[model samples]
Target: MSAPAPPSSSSSSSSSSGLVLQGADDVEDCVWENEGEGSLPWDRFGYVSDLVRNGNRAFRQHRLEFFEKAVSYYTRANQIKPNDPVILGNRCATYIRISQFLKLRSASDSEDRPLSGLDPTIHAELALKDAEKLVDIQCNSVRSFVLKASALLLLEKYDTARDTVISGLQVDPFSNSLQGALQQLEKIHASCTGSRSNTKPERTDDFDCTLCLKLLYEPITTPCGHSFCRSCLFQSMDRGNKCPLCRTVLFISPRTSAVSVTLNNIIQKNFPEEYAERKSEHDSLTNLGGDLMPLFVMDIVIPCQKYPLHIFEPRYRLMVRRIMEGNRRMGMVGIDPLTGSFAEFACEVEVTECEPLPDGRFFIEVEGRRRFRIIRSRDQDGYRVAEVEWVQDVEFPQGSRERVDLLELTSNVAEHASSWLTRARQAAQQDRAKYEKLLSLEHMMPTPRDPERFSFWLATLTKRRPDEKLDLLRMTDTRERISRGLIYLRAEEQGCRLQ
Candidate 1:
């Protein structure tokens, strides 16, 4: 009422609260006293009420608006408190999250060339530099460090990212996301090893995924007579369906037995312990046994379908023999992202049906069991080796896998999804139709309980890389994963239709 004091306030109808304040404000001051520091007493500095408001807004119900406000305010805040660790740390996080949303939006919004350069993931990074400035200011948050590492890694600053995450892990060891990020960087670096000729496993005490060499989970043996997690093999096969070890074709023509009696002699001779572990795990019934599955040192990717794995690679043949006589299950793992050997995450698979081929291969139908994420792979004597930690989301029956007439529900869902796909396809442009169709189906799956079958069915509809399919397969959370699958398939259908 008294001329608004220093006359810092203004009215704006476009924004939520019209009261925009103005005053003798110095951005370098970082903190501004409501009535001037002379009028108030405190070392209180490096923050402003506007910054708080913007931060709060960023986290509020209307997140988009909040983030927009944060972008402007935080940019101003960063300039003033550029070296203030707390301010820098917080601002860094705010930028990263905001940027993530923006980048994703830009990606999805821009079809021909999804917005790339100016995305928030980029801006969030600049904010991160400001955070690093806070190291001298003695302010760092675990969140800040992790985000920084993630940002750097995404930007392909692999070495710096790995170092930053390692430092953060020393400070906070329980950050699983950090662990994943570190592994990702290591995987990239590990790629420097020549080509497939260098694919030999150095040690077998701990097995590495032949493809990426992280940790193994849901480990799947390729029909080509090579073993790796479904995700790892799938990812490699995605580019060109080939064995990670021998470059043998996996999905083309007929898979052969590369494991000759000579190779079996090598494995048995080179590292018996690891070979025994592999054999024991493959043969043991109840596979990994109860909750102990996740606690194990190895992870695998398990597939839901069965193939007559009757190939006569003596090592694999013997392994399958044991698995079939018992649980009839195998694990699927990927190459470790760190060591680039075996990935830690994998799934436990149980065979529901198995029919031996006339050629001694196996044709089987299987269901997924426990899931795992690769942790660390250690070398043994001979066989490719490593320990895996379980990380997949396996739902308790009470959790998301409740028994129901899924077949009927999925049938109805598929029908609804198909209609959406057809319509969106017709409405969208040629190149856009497929993605849109997938999104439509994915968006609709949640309302239906039997979306699992629909999700898998939709999975079959799209010809994605094996890696993409495995991502869908690893989704143990029926409702959500299926929802994702529905969207992807329907979007593809729609996009194709439009074209």
Candidate 2:
């Protein structure tokens, strides 16, 4: 080399001071000897907490570059002090922030927007792994367990989230975060009873409801192993209680059927767009009527009549809770054997009193209000819902003669019914207890001041077939129901005379 430029005074000074310049060979030899010993592990850990805070701030700014720089700092710290609890915790937190930031971005952007990079779930999974590592490294650290549980929750791995929570509680029972997480999980489980499907078929065809000829909506799985939209299946059942696909006999009632949790979840997860559209369509349909009302599938409710109920089932308890939340109104329909569903005509009832028990059961008293006929029906949370068309009495012709004739007819029917009731009670005297019970119930029967309504209630209490009662319930003309009642009463009285 040119004259190896004389080592200036530095060489001369090294000779006097016994200090020699390090050669490349010497530097290479010492590189591994004490690579990171100058920085203590604790120093590296100290930097991690600051890096995590900066990372959080960068994430808030939506500056991916700055966030990534913070992440790099954390990584450097972690490498400097491998497996340091503080470093591991900070790195895990950084990963979680990254995922959250990405998730927020995705939520704010249009659905059709193209993703720029890796999915946020990948980061969430990575964070979950880090959190698990932290938990394993520090078994008793409540913070570690909380972090792990949070990661699992974000991943939508609920069972593992629960396990993480239980493990944390085992270590420290008084952790408020862990307890709150556990309670939240329980609420989710109860509320979304029919959640995600586990054994999903490879093809999308498996999820379709046969009746609707599309994807299942509010799917309920019957005992026959076939799934259908709640409304579609109910409509099919209206013709006959059998599985639509398999034609298997089913004894399911709207009150007792449970929605398939697994299928619901799978549909929500895989077909989010379609599911959202379906939900919007369903909501729009249900809200078409004035304040959609829950349909109570039990005995018919007549206006001004008392409807006492003992609510014990979980589904009914939920229904009653919703009822109390709103106007305390519910529609009551009789179970129609002919249709295999509730009668088309129904009545609305308002809860007047409710006594809730410790076990979520209730003793509720209600009074009937107006009559309605089901225009359409659907299932909701193991209950029936309907779009209804209200029915009212056909007002008599606006004339004195029509009013007089109506009054005369109602009076004649009431007298005939009274005579027939007395004769029947006398005829049934051989069974005095049975006759006495009928007499006792007579006082409890609804007797409105309005003659038309009174005649309707009379027909309600009369010994008649279910179909006959349903006919009386559906009659819009109160006068017609009274005339029909007279004929039935006369036939009953003649039969008694023959006996």
Candidate 3:
């Protein structure tokens, strides 16, 4: 028997009936009479014919259960005659029929009566597989291309489906079914394109990040031409440096690859409300609140200090990327020696410069900003996030005797700190690294007018222990902190003289 003709359209119900076994009632008898002339045994041929007949009969019933039964019967027939184009075509058609029926069924009907079998997408996938095999078996046949196109269309692969229809027309240019399918595909494609060009394009996958399934925020288009939200792309790259959509090996890093400004502007301009919502969601992750911050459990950082950090661990790399995208600030905490966990008090630091290395590491320079005491902390995406209360030094009233004394003390300490740093730099003139460090410290000095910040800058002039730095962060008495800073500077100067 010849393969069935292609369906007139993907949505046509007649596609299912197009594959009915020709003279199925008499197929067994015909097989029996021609047994001697054919290769198959008489009994097996008859059995295969009967299976095909039963599948056709069930398929004609036009019910989901009957379609499933048709698939079963056709599957058994195909197994008996492994390469039978007729059997493959009939099964492929049945699968497409079931998929179309399921898709066209009213939402209310689906909600009222739940389905338990394979879903529409799965059926289309199965149909596509069968259609592929049929094409391989009969390359010159228009029916094969038609079946493949029908399956592709059902799966929403419009481009490939259109190509398949064109290929079918090449095989049989006069085939009415293939011609009709090509026209239908063109209309569908035109409708989709027209809809997107409207003044306010509908919220479709065109503007969505496949990874987040939301409107794109800070969309970063890859070299392969796929776009994703900046955070989503890098977060995925943390696992492996490849494009999530195409799996192309990505050479771009967060620091180097900038956002697609044009695409981002289009999304923002077209869908203002949705874009605002996406921005709000993204901001919530980056900046939790005024008092809440993500913490980097590393070392103690005092205000007015600058340091370079190498972020290699996956969790930290993720955190640093988010920070760079957000406010470029995070709390830096060190382990508490006694508790062996994150310290109670930490200093906020702002990322001054960030360089993303090729091996997925970050070389970053950060400067300390302010201090905060962690009230409560929790884990977020493999990092610690804390609710904190900002720490500030108690200020004496202006022009008061106590305030004047404090100001005098601050000025004296600043002079002593500056003298100590000049001497330290001279002593370290032979050591290039140490000399450079002293110069950097010199640049970080804050004026005595802001005594709290000046105190921290003074402490940075000398290499102090982490505990001492933490104590300085905890100290609210500006005069005492300045005095302690002066003591640290004097001790370092004395040690340098001895050396």
Least well predicted 10-residue stretch by lDDT in candidate 2? 21-30
lDDT of 2 by residue, 206-301 (tens): 878877778787788776677888666645654455677887755443213435656787788778778898887765544434746688787876
Using TM-score as the measure, which candidate wins? 3
lDDT of 1: 0.45
Off by over 4 Å in 1: 1-288, 291-310, 335-340, 352-370, 375-457, 473-480, 495-499
**RMSD each, Å:** 26.2, 29.9, 27.9
Q: Which number leads on lDDT?
A: 3
Compute the lDDT of residue 278 as modeled in candidate 1: 59
Question: Which of 2 and 3 is the better model by lDDT?
Answer: 3
Model 1 TM-score relative to the real fold:
0.29
Q: Deviation in angstroms for 339 in model 2?
A: 3.0
TM-score of 3: 0.57
